[model samples]
Target: MWKLNPRALKYLNEVARFGSLRKVAAHLNVDVSAISRQLAQLEEELGTAVGMRSGQGFVLTQVGEELVALFRQQKASEAAALSRIEALQSLKRGRVSIAVGEGFIADLISAPLQAFMARYPGIQISVEMAGANEATRLVKEDRVDLALVYAPSPDAELYSHVVTRQPLELITPPGHPLTRLAPLSIRQISGYPLALIDQQFGMGQLVSLVEELEHIRFEPQLRTNSVAVLKNFVLSGMGVTFMPGLTVHSEIKQGRIACVPVPHPVLAGASAHIVSHKGRELTVSAEALINHLHDGMLFFN
Candidate 1:
């Protein structure tokens, strides 16, 4: 068995994250040459290059990424071990990272997130917004403890803790012409000026699927990757957009946006999934948040 030095692994992981030895060195208050030496020794021991110089920085090779992922797993294990030891103290402290789609951000912040942070003030949580594919990749890579994705595709390496039907709706300006036609077809929606997200997002993926199945394409007045922007576009009366109904509840309540159903099977059956890496043991804090979301969030309800 090959034993990697802990210090060397630390240097490698930091370099990979920062994408530059100099940046890692500056962040760690060490000399760039020192960090370089450690990585060189690591590569020599492994008999292969971990990464190569790219543009202005270094990019990891496949082996390099795997090694960084290994370091992350080891850190997660250590955190879990510490959590067990701290059980008597009632989870006094820990950290959790989660990725989410922009559409789910408001719902997460509205309830479960606020309640959890208030209850567990000592536990730190970091949230990042990512597309469905990127969200799954982050959890699988151990970069995040959990993810909240809309219309997530199946993956063998992930486990879904919560899945709920949160159908995609066509968002329009309040009292807009589209509201007269609830449960509109995709072809009908195309006749109006539209705003849509690109295919990197899960909602966008479902929209693309609908277009393919129905053999019709939509020429949108605007294209973006943000649900917030799409919401604003509708509120500003630029045009209609497509997203989950839960995302625009506040706007609907304020009579700023009108959400109508789209009858495509994919849109009608859209779901929100909270997932984690399969077969990995979560720290006590992460598990608690998962339960909180399952029990408290409107997405799960």
Candidate 2:
């Protein structure tokens, strides 16, 4: 009988990832001593030192590294088997997990989710709101079956399908002075106190364009990750912001906000993308949803 159990392997993997047995224990909600004992048992079963303390950190041995690779393969095989068993029932009955940016949640995902739920009420759908970077990471790590993100620069490990292209518009409170202009240049907008998204966000690329055109740095009166907050700030006469045209459409029509076209050097466009791990096979439900999103993009166009 194999002395090392799957639980021990899981502990080893966790320790390797977290770098501390205490952290692994906390994450797994187990006692630190228990994790230590498990590691000792695993090392004894394999007849090798799996990990060693170095400079107040645990470092995995070569044997530990090899074992971790095998353990991950085993886990993946188990997951595939489970997925296959679930898929055998009904594709629509299985769960589909998607990680998406907050900006796309209300406009893009809400309608599709409503329609999908109406058709297949039994299908479980989990939507996690994450930033574009986190969305990419979640999809690549297989934590989520699919992700909706703004396409960043191309990367070899991801396969992206552009769902829709949204134009960026300068948004301000209704009847703001900028609304009177047919088109405004970056320099013209630089005079206002900007309410901008931070540099890590997808929309931050737009700020870079304005910076280059105006040859001056913007000191935002407010910086936020939430589009709703930025919209509210603009509406309340706090500051102006740049956002995708789709996001401000209702407000623009309602006269709560005004959107003006920005000129050439400061032009901004972003594409909504459905991304998946480059070579991984997507679950049936994930594939179905991807197809649905592709179909849905036609309506937006």
Candidate 3:
């Protein structure tokens, strides 16, 4: 016979992740002795040593790994069950956390988020703006229920849906010289002062790839992580910046900026995707949010 206790499972899981009882206790804001005692009690009940001291810190035994895996599976199953229960009562009560790339956050949430919340007023929603890599990491770590990112790598742990290709564009102040060029090549665009996204943002890899493929290095007038700052620089006629259409769609429509397609080989294949964790069933609220995103993407393009 096996007894399930949430407290025991929580302690074990934290210990497995932190690799030290003291660290886990600190993270949980509990006394180290209490965590040690609880862990010892868990081991006694299970009749096995779950963790062993190593040179660096605690290492989980085989039994511990199996127990942790089972605990995760059970936790996921319980969450799914709760979702079903909530659906029976009403679809209005649930929460979904979404991590989105900064550039697409406005377009991604502008129409769809309002619609979803309007339909289900009781549902709670949280959206965090992050770079593509950080957004993918959040989804993989289950820190967020879903992720919307540009050019994310294929992840085995994620199920991608609602994919869309967004071509890069050269954004400039109105009546800029580059606007005369319908499609500008990388070499041609390099002639002007440029404001580029910094390496800290995930798009730096794309820039690096473009540099390698085109064999050209740009002497940027400015490099920043904020899209707004880049837009301001271009608006002020300081320099031109490259960005996806979604980032500057409104400005282009209002004639505050002009955009020419950047027909670079490296940028032709850039895409945006909505992804969720693989192998785990999504809650009804999460599923509803995904449906809204899918609908939003149709118009986003």
Candidate 4:
């Protein structure tokens, strides 16, 4: 039978988290040699190498990935147990980390994050802004408790909740001729100068798919990975862009931009989702925040 020590598990999981033994050692307030010793012992006992040293740093083996996942489950169980104990004493304390797209911060995440923090001052929260695919990756890697992003293709490792479907919208500077139109089509919009988000992002992928299906190509006047920069391009009257309403709800309300829903058959099918690791029990802090998100997303619509 293989026996695991708590300290060894912590060290291994931290190494996976930071991708550095030195960083893990510093975080755990232990000597660097201690981490190495325990890691060596762990692999020796398990009859497999958890990680191998490389020129750049430590890289987890296939076994190491499985072990790390098990460790995350263990940590989640510990958190759930602690939540039970805390409830008996009327105390709540834990950290909740989220991975979300940058566009979600202003409209979808901000209010709920603030409310959750205010309600549970003892909880610690961290948010990482990333692209939709990056957000999904973060959740899968156990780097974050939850993710808010455009619907990623189904993955068995993830569970999606709090879903919302919104058509992609054509965004333009105030008083652009397209604004006067009731609804817009990809073919119609492609005729104008275009500013496009990069394909690494979900929005970009959606637009690219439509272009390919329609047998048309958009020669963008500006192309960028940054949503803020793309918005700026539109703001400066550089070119029209396509984005979901949730991304630019504030701007539309303030009359700084105009958003007309895309009439493309596929654009109407896009959606947003809140996601977490499948089959993992959430910590009290994470559960609370997810509840807040579910409620607050009503306004995001």
Candidate 5:
């Protein structure tokens, strides 16, 4: 069995994160030569070159990528162990990192996050807005403390809880012809050019639902990954879009955009979930944020 030194692993992890050994050494307040020596020792132990000098910086080799995975797994385990011990002490000031989708940011988390900040003034909060795939990737990579994503994974290594259930609705300009209809079906919506989120977005899941209910293929006049752009297009009367109810609530109330319930029952069942990596421990701030989220979710129900 190969023995891994924690210090060397730390050095490697920092190097990988910063993309420069000199920067890693500077952050750690160590000599650059010391970092170089540690990297050499690590490569010797692994019996392969983990990284190579590129101009003024270093780039990871394939072996380095594998080492990074191993190091991250070990680091996560150690962090979990420390967190358990710390939890027994008390929940105090700590940092929490979260990744979420843009739609959820506008609809669900923004207000609660602001309130959380006000309550836990000592706790540091970091948030990253990304697509569902990127959100999941961040959680899996241990880059984020928690992720709120649109889709759920069946993987046993991921723990998921439904934070909120948002019904999908078709939105158009307030006085659009479709607004007069009692309820609009997917087939009827397909008759017009649709503005949709690109396939990478969670909204792309609706495509299958649309296909199941309607025989006609959709021809999207505009496709964007940005929730803001999608809403702008819909509000401008350029084209109609299928979006979560929370996303356009204010617009609907203001009579700028009209939301019609999807006639297909299956389309209404889409939900957003809060997910975390399995076996990972939550920091003090992370746990508090999760509790706040649970409380906020009650409003959706």
Candidate 6:
């Protein structure tokens, strides 16, 4: 008998990741003693210590490292198998999971993804709103079949199926004094009350990089990870924010918000991407939906 327990493997991976049994227990909403007992049984079965605690945190043994790698591959393969089985339905039935950055949600629901749902009502779709890092992580972990990200960090295990230029712009309430400047400079933007996204998001990261390169900084009145909050900050005439125009396209069209170009070369060249695991084959439904998003969304267009 193989004597392998997927549940034990799952607990081991979480312990390795979090580096503490108590922390993993809290995260998994289980008792710490339960995790310990499971791990003890695992060690008994394998007849080896998989990990050890140190001053820093838990460190996996060489054997444990290899086992984790194998476990990850097994999970990725299982995801692929599910995708293949979903393909057997010919798009009439299947579930497609997508992780999207909060900044892209406005555009995603309005046209691109909604159109896909209409076209294939039989297909089940799950959309998770996450920050840039979380979105990529979800794809990398095979928890999501696809991710829509802006200014994604390069990853060897991730592939970009669609990349479109989505320049970061200065957004303000309609007729705000800054709108007159059209393409504004960072210094000029800083002169106003600034409400910026935190470093967890792509726009915030880009702005921080520019500040570092230019040896300057802005004292933002507010900082957050929520796109809705940023938009509300601008719409309330409280302050200005930096975001892609497409993120607030409907508001701009309604003449409630004004999106002015930011002339910085880095901001001007920013792009959004459709990302997926490198070697995983997407189902027919997943593939078709990606195509729909590319063609139907203003974010891509």
Predicted model with the maximum TM-score: 1
Tens digits of lDDT, candidate 3, 89-168: 78969888999877876686667788888999988999998887788877765678888877776678788867788766
Please say which candidate is ahead in lDDT: 1 or 6.
1
lDDT values of the candidates?
0.88, 0.74, 0.79, 0.82, 0.77, 0.85
Worst 10 residues of 4 by lDDT: 84-93
Q: Candidate 5 regions off by >4 Å?
A: 7-70, 81-90, 108-110, 152-156, 212-215, 297-301
TM per candidate comes to 0.86, 0.79, 0.85, 0.85, 0.77, 0.85
Instruction: Give RMSD (Å) of candidate 1 vs. truth.
Output: 2.8
* 1-301 per-residue lDDT for model 6 (tens digits): 5577788788888877788888899999999889888877878888998888788676888867767766777876775577677667766777789999988887888767777888888889999988888889888767798999999877898999999999999989998898888557788887899988878788888899899977899899998888999999999999899999988988999999999998898899999999998877677778888899989887776
* Model 4 agreement with the true structure over 14-107: per-residue lDDT tens digits: 8988888998888889899999999999999999899999987899999988888889898777877887676665446778889988767776
Deviating ranges (above 4 Å) for candidate 6: 1-7, 22-48, 55-57
What clash pairs does model 4 have?
none
lDDT of 4 at 213: 98
Best by lDDT: 1
Q: Mind giving the per-residue lDDT tens digits that candidate 1 earns over 1-301?
A: 7899889889888887788988999999999999889889989999999889888698888988888878878887897888877666897888889999988888889878999999999999999989999999889867899999989887898999889999998999988888997567788888888999988899899989988998988898899988888988998898898988889888888888888988878889989998999877788988899899989877886
What local lDDT does model 2 show for residue 189?
A: 79
lDDT of 2 by residue, 195-293 (tens): 887655567766765677668787788888888888889989887998876676667788888888776543545566788877666666677678877
* lDDT (Cα) of model 4: 0.82
Candidate 6 overall lDDT versus native:
0.85
Candidate 1: which stretches are off by over 4 Å?
Answer: 15-29, 47-66
